[model samples]
Target: MDDASSQSRPSADQPNPFSAVPIEITISVGKARPLIRDLLKLGKDAVLPLDKRVDDAVELYVGERLIARGELEELEGDQQGQLAVRLTEVADLQDGLG
Candidate 1:
């Protein structure tokens, strides 16, 4: 076989770099406190309270583990809001969820 034909042969042990990585993402959860009756009665100026406090850091859970905490903030230019997490420790890429 020629050099080109030899090189063209596929290797069995080669790893595919295009393989997708597994990543687990968790959003901050908050409870909305409003009765069904109250929810129906809500009109223009109705104010419903949440279970979490304003100063409290929002909890983020990846699968079953509590990964990190962060403060919610609204983006200036964009309409969508964002969360900035203060990472306590670097998550183990191999052991932990990607």
Candidate 2:
């Protein structure tokens, strides 16, 4: 390899950059805010209501920034019953992770 090309490449000791790194994508189904008294009064099998319904689109976030919106779905096949999101509205990031 030429010296110029070798110099431009990342060394083995250096990190692989964000391309190979993993970032946690948080999926927010809904939010529920209960009073402190009501929060503490919860018991086993008790249900706390959320702002959204079962048919509502869930929000995806990377950190605090909202990334995309999608509907909740159950997987088929061996992964059946596993919950997933089908993105309906994705943000225009323009190369940004957020």
Model 1, stretches more than 4 Å misplaced?
1-24, 43-46, 63-65, 73-82, 88-98
lDDT of 1 by residue, 1-98 (tens): 46997575656786444546776668565779687998999999878888888767666777766666666666555655654555444445457533
Candidate 1 backbone collisions, by pair: none
How would you encode candidate 2's per-residue C-alpha lDDT over 1-84 as one tens digit per residue?
568977767788886576688899999989999999999999999999999998998999999888899999999999999999
86 Cα displacement, candidate 2 (Å): 0.6
TM values, all candidates: 0.45, 0.77
